[model samples]
Target: MRTTPVERPTVLRRRSYTWFPVVSGAGFYVAAIALPLEHGDGFASAILLTGISYFCWLIGWNSSFRFTRTHVSVTNVLVTTTADWRDVAGVDIEGGLAGLLRDGRSLDSIAFGGSLIGEFTGYRTHRRACRLLRQGWWGAGPGRRGKGPVPVRTSVEWRRALAIATALYVPVVLVQGLGG
Candidate 1:
């Protein structure tokens, strides 16, 4: 009996330096807890915590980019987009990291771009990865190139969680502020 061949997945992730966000998030959380206990009311603490939470969330969420032989994926704060390589028209690194799709919608990558914060965010590695991805690797689509089509899928649980958190945060802060 003949068996079907299996394709291997090539996963490339962000190569960010860890100290900055980790240290900053820790500092903010510590301040959030300490500031309130020391002098301010719970309202102040709530706002501080919310701000820090949002910062940490973005830092954690948008810290990677991944691609495979079949599909390409871009992750940003709260969302990850996985699309067939064929679906992507091209990549744009002009303002930052972005993927232009055949549908005209662009997918932006968080940690994969050049920015003023590059010094602290380890954007160099991401920039290199972006270059590598744009190197005609996804030229597997049919028609002009005559390659083939790739199936794709995406996950949004993190985005949903972020949305839910944002929704709950406002109410919680308001209640605490008004209660006492």
Candidate 2:
């Protein structure tokens, strides 16, 4: 009798919303260069605005790309990130915007659960996973053997990533705005 070897699924590639930062940054730089220089303090303001825009752009672009490119491998024994494999306790799959907001109270519930009024409570990785699953892009299926790749996350992940990127860039922009 012939038997077929079970194929192990691995993440061949990964991508994130990395273009946002790049495009924003490029626009900032272009504007900075193209904008007319005004006399006295206004010149400084233009320069500052340009700098802030560039800073925001870089942060958004880098973080988005970095998070998206991250990949993992699933195995019988464990799941692996780029560096190490740890025993995963569980996988929580939160739906997308519709899933989370379906009740129109999910946002409030999430805030209450986390015990913070406006704290960002999502991870980009989670959103990516959810998206892949929804599109049936994860490439995993049912097997009598065991549980397949678990899905977890929501669009909040993207929001969090954006928030973080913005936070990092905002201060610098503000400072420049003030000084300029």
Candidate 3:
């Protein structure tokens, strides 16, 4: 007997939050200019602020790129994509930040649920698969509803990237915090 292949769900096309990049980039630029003027520690401060600002801008740019893609299709076999792809086994949405903290990396598997706020509105995904994809992009995994990964931001690869960024921003943030 011949068997027919199962049809995959139609892929959904969604773009990443556009406002995040714009707002973040603008904020960074302003900080870059304002920091030196207020702090004025010579070229070092200027360079530091500029570098920090550029890094923020790059984050925004990368976010935009990450979200901008043709389409994403979830199939019975596997998730298919023509654009950059990330995947998690499942997803679950529970309490607020408090719950998230308790869940740990397990929550990382699923996309965190929350109300649309500020520049994050555009990033909202109603579909489970889409949410999982976004979480994966953010370095989180997909988890079964009600169940989550071990800890948030536990992805070693993503953690490394974040660590690098944090290391670069530490001085700048400290200076800013110190009223510089």
Q: Number of the top candidate by TM-score?
A: 1
Tens digits of lDDT, candidate 2, 1-180: 999775443321223334555567667655654444344554455556556664554344322211111222221111122211111221234432212211122211111122132135664434554464223322223321224443332323345445645654465455445554
Off by over 4 Å in 1: 1-19, 33-47, 60-63, 113-126, 135-155, 159-180
Kindly provide the TM-score of model 1 when superposed on the true structure, using C-alpha atoms.
0.54
TM-scores across all candidates? 0.54, 0.33, 0.31
What is the lDDT for 149 in model 3?
31
* lDDT assessment of candidate 3: 0.38
TM-score winner between candidates 1 and 2? 1
Which stretches of candidate 2 lie above 4 Å from their native place?
1-17, 65-83, 87-91, 95-180
Note the clash tally of each candidate. Answer: 1, 4, 18
Ranking by lDDT: 1, 3, 2
Between prediction 2 and prediction 3, the one with superior TM-score is 2
For model 3, the superposed segments whose C-alpha errors exceed 4 Å read 1-18, 21-23, 30-42, 54-89, 95-105, 109-180
- Tens-digit lDDT track of model 3 for 1-180: 999776443332222433555476567655654554354464466456556655544443322112222222221111111222232233343331111222343222111234446125543353444464455444433333344433212112344445655755665566565664
Judge candidate 2 at residue 161 and give its lDDT.
48
